[model samples]
Target: MSPRPDTAARQQPSPSSPPSDRVRRFTRAERWVHRTTAALMGVCVATAACLYLPEFAELVGRRDLVVRLHEWAGLLLPLPLLAGLASRALRADLGRLNRFGPHDGTWLREALRGRRGPAGKFNAGQKIYASWLAGATLVMLGTGLVMWFTHLTPLMWRTSATFVHDWLALTLGVVLAGHIGMALRDPESRTGLRTGTVDRAWAEREHELWRP
Candidate 1:
């Protein structure tokens, strides 16, 4: 017999999602965590441009303020996620992000062929993206710290950190733009992120492995 789908963890009913046809895709806590992280990242990127790009820097004369904001935002980037550890729903979803099962492989193959396939609460690509994002966040944080406190790090490491931090910031901006574009293009995903629930039919069609 085939293994069953992971059971849905229900929460307080959302007014935006009708009871008969909606499925809980993200909990309120999960959405808040995502929102907080996005906001912090945006600030970091915006201030980074102000500090690093000459043209952008010309538009803003407050170098100290920009540096302070960027540094603090980078430092606090992980707070929401850490605080979210108190959320059972977020913990469960994080576990899902950590694993790749058979359906994920099949889904990835079909995706490469330009067709959709069965996916769980998170798809294979999403799993990979999440992993990459987590790793990148940590690396950026470490590099940012080294760059910030120049006295502690060796000159060579400081130079290396600056190089990594700059290039990684550029790469993250591109990746985040793609992520935002994809989210905006998918109404169901946008709605789910905003309201913490999605149409059951949409979930059934797109995330079949997540359904019972």
Candidate 2:
């Protein structure tokens, strides 16, 4: 025999080992909820824009039809968000997001200067956005329902609800535009949100404190 079967040469150790210390930031279900909400929000916003824009109104004529579509979209908007909130893990993450400390302030200061800061799991801005979106969505849903069911409210209340609903929609649209721009600004972040996984380097660089 050329060599004994049990006498093969041993291999040397490799420079790098497999990652065994990383933590799971988002579960599969949580990711699914996030993605679904994002998709629905995109469609709703686009449809609302088409209905609102004077030039595009001809394509989606009939005020009743536009109102019905908007109402349905608004009704569906909170499902994913509420589902995600049902997970205990996600609720804990929300708690972490709400916590504001010295680090968060420092991160905001640096962010304002056009530099990346040491953001933990989430920066101050992200936390604020999450909170704002939560409140805005609730407001939108309540006001939207009042507008949709005009028979349940007095004429003046319905008019006020209509004003609140429209203004909140406009505000949320602008905020979402900023959110999308920020997501696009960082390829790794965008990838993470899309795939629910990110490279170790990305986590370390952007959220060092988050890695276990």
Candidate 3:
């Protein structure tokens, strides 16, 4: 049977025209939660630097003010995420972050080779980071609280908490730097995060498993 020209033409996209389909990647609530968490995280990092580095301490001047800011920022680190739990979609996404799938293993291997494979809304690397950060945030908060309430914690525990908090802060700073570096290099990811939407072709290519 001979196919009609019109039928064949409609079956495939035109080569000359760019795909116009766009998909929503992040909801308004999701964007707001991410931005709020980011701002608080930045405050925690900056104040920690001010307290730990002599140069930053001199620049910041008021040690008391910096200490208070650091304590509050670290304490509130999980608040945005907690608030986001109201959204069913956000809660579902959190579950996805906590689980590892077969495709995620393949994605990790491809990622090492500087290639991308099919992934859901969040890839293996992102899931790993999110999972780690969730636990790390709790650890930091617990240690920070122990240090803050010295009256409640024994001298030995306080000393141990202080050491843990200091070292964890440094580790988090390095991981965050790498996260920011990757974000800066990936324009489509950046655009999707900012605009809450991504080009259909890009989404289909990079996140074929993602469904919205």
Best by TM-score: 1
Residue-by-residue lDDT tens digits, candidate 1, 104-146: 9999999999999889999998999899999999999999999
On lDDT, the leading prediction is 1
Can you list the residue pairs that collide in candidate 3?
none
Off by over 4 Å in 3: 1-20
Better of 1 and 2 by TM-score: 1
- What's the TM-score of every candidate structure? 0.90, 0.83, 0.88
Give lDDT tens digits, candidate 3, residues 142-205: 9999999999989999999989999999999999999999999889998877878889888888
Candidate 2: the clashing residue pairs are none
Clashes (N, CA, C under 3 Å) per candidate: 0, 0, 0
lDDT of 2 by residue, 1-212 (tens): 56655454334333343244333456666788888888777777877787778877777678677767777877898888677887887788878888988888888999899888878888789999999998998898898788778888999989998899888889999999999898888887766666556667778888867844
C-alpha lDDT score of every prediction, in listed order: 0.91, 0.78, 0.89
- Residue pairs with backbone atoms closer than 3 Å in model 1 (clashes): none
Candidate 2, which segments miss by more than 4 Å at Cα?
1-23
RMSD for each of the candidates = 7.3, 5.2, 6.4
TM-score of 2: 0.83
